[model samples]
Target: MPLKMDAAALNAFLDQAFEQVADDFVVEDVATDRLTVRLEVSDKHLRPGGTVSGPTMFALADVGAYLMTLARIGPQALAVTTNCAIDFMHKPAARTDLLGEVRLLKLGKQLSVCDVLIYSKGQEPPVARASLTYAIPPQ
Candidate 1:
């Protein structure tokens, strides 16, 4: 299916629907098969070792999946994560933004499964990877 929302539309939707975290993430790119999101890292997102925290990475994955679903299905603010599996592979760079590259594995009427790879800006290898399933509310 073609995208129902683009980067600008998705960002606006985030601001209107989830104002609290709207500033933390930016929808960088929206394409037919993938969505790219950026997490603007701050001190609050860091851990003791000066690296991005696991929870921070997970949030990016979750939000990326949510936005990717919304891009195809239109703005569905009620869509919620039903399952998540994350792996922290490499430590992220300190004080660097993270990028989540999300791809939809399956997009059904009731659910969406997305795979996300998170990389610290300018890093070659992914710092973390996540698989997320979102439950789509009936329209």
Candidate 2:
């Protein structure tokens, strides 16, 4: 399906709909196969060991998946995550930004599934991987 929202549109939607964390994330690229989002790392995102917190990574995956779905289905702020499974593979680079690469695995009338790989900036291997299922609101 063709995209209903591009990176700019998605960013605008985030700003308007989720202003609380809008400044923390940036929609870097939007394409048919993938959407890339960057999380600006700050002290609040770090844990005691100077690594990115698991919750921060999960948030990136969730937001990335949500935006990926909205990119195809248009801005539906009510669409919510119904399920999420995440694996923390490696320690994230200290004080480095994280990038989430989202791939839509399935998009249907009621559900949208996405696979999200999180990586520290300049890293090759993924630091975490997440599978998320979103409940699409009825049209």
List clashing residue pairs in candidate 1: none
- Candidate 2 regions with alpha-carbon error over 4 angstroms: none
Over 1-139, each residue of candidate 2 has an lDDT whose tens digit, in order, gives 8999999999999999999999999999999769999999999999998999999999999999999999999999999999999999999999999999999999999999999999999997999999999999999
Candidate no. 1 TM-score: 0.98
Which residue pairs come into collision in candidate 2?
none
CA RMSD of all predictions = 0.6, 0.6
Model 1 misses residue 40 by how many Å?
A: 0.5
- Expressed as tens digits, the lDDT of each residue in 38-72 for candidate 1 is 99999999999899999999999999999999999
RMSD of 1: 0.6
Displacement of the residue 59 alpha carbon in candidate 2, Å: 0.2
**True-structure lDDT of candidate 2:** 0.97
The local lDDT score (0 to 100) that residue 13 gets in candidate 1 is 99
Alpha carbon lDDT of each predicted model: 0.96, 0.97
lDDT of 1 at 46: 92
